[model samples]
Target: MLAFLYPGLGHVYLREWLRALVWFFLNVTSFTLLMPADAVPETFGWSELVAAAENVTPEAALALAAITVFSMIDAYWMAKRQNTETEVEEGTTCPNCGRDVDSDLEFCHWCTERLNPESDEAEETADDSGANA
Candidate 1:
């Protein structure tokens, strides 16, 4: 995915604006700080880093690009893992009684009507063995 090749894009796809902003800020800041200080003349904060990268040997450029690409991949993996856990949590809540239920439950454990009824059968089912005793 193109999102995995560019940092913060995956968060944007997930609609997490604050996370995207933080990821972009942190990556840019760290990249700026890690470049060799005297390798390039400073202009703006970012211009110095861009100049340093451009002036570097081809191997250095490749290494920096690889690092950036891996960071984006890490962000995408983290977002997907978080989204999956959230979906699982959302699906397991009981709608009728607001109780936590297993994902496979057909009816709320506290209220034993089908999740949806046909309207012909009574909502409540009586236990007849207790009555016979």
Candidate 2:
């Protein structure tokens, strides 16, 4: 998938903040390390890249190219897998009490109150009295 083609995109889609950050840092670091020394000094312009490639040994350029290609593939694959798994597990969590709820459920099972609707004032008063005992 195109997600794997670019690292961190998959994690972004999945809403995995830490995983996305790690993927971004890793891909960037690897790409930077694999690039030629001259390539590091300048903005990553096409001409600079070409000049570096022309100056560097063929073996170095090939290795760098391989690394960049492989990293892209790795990122894409990770994103695809994360997206699939996350979609299956996604559900709403209660903001007030931190309870997990099914997406279809409008109320928290534990609290037995309307999640997004107006709560009955009388019911709340009765519950409060019971809780104080």
Candidate 3:
């Protein structure tokens, strides 16, 4: 929604200051390049702004709109990727319920299923003995 309002605003919300500034400047440059001199609003008001927007060429509007959509998608994808990375770092998935469970727990907190601590110990012991040999 932020990106919809202005290209790269979503990045600003995501704490990507440099990316947001670049996108904001890019969109501003595009608008300046495409704006007709006659379309410049003479007054600072809603009516004047609407008139200016109405005067914008279809090509300019379409280009800016495309950039806005692209920015929104990029922000959303990056946010999701960051969340996934954090989840991977902090925990493991419960096999029984296919949900995240804390790594420190002996069983799946969601499903309450035993995680075979004995087998894990046994494997560790076997590996240690093999290393000693």
Give all TM-scores, in the order shown.
0.42, 0.39, 0.65
- lDDT by residue (tens digit), candidate 3, 1-133: 7888888888888888898988899899988898798778988899999898899899988888888888889888867877887765433776677787777888997789766667789999999999999
Q: How far is candidate 1 from the true structure (C-alpha RMSD, Å)?
A: 8.5
Give per-residue CA lDDT, model 1, range 35-103, as digits (tens): 555556666678776776576666555555765676577667777787787774675766677777776
Model 2 TM-score relative to the real fold: 0.39
Query: What is each predicted model's overall lDDT from 0 to 1?
Result: 0.64, 0.65, 0.83
Candidate 3 positional error at 8, Å: 1.1
RMSD of each: 8.5, 10.3, 4.8
Q: Which structure among the candidates has the greatest TM-score?
A: 3
lDDT of 3 at 53: 86
Candidate 2 per-residue lDDT over residues 1-133, each given as its tens digit: 4344566665676566786677678667766666567655376788876776676766656755564466566666676786687663444766567777776787788776566555456677889999999
Query: After superposing candidate 3, which stretches have Cα over 4 Å from the reference?
Result: 44-50, 87-91, 97-99, 109-112, 117-133
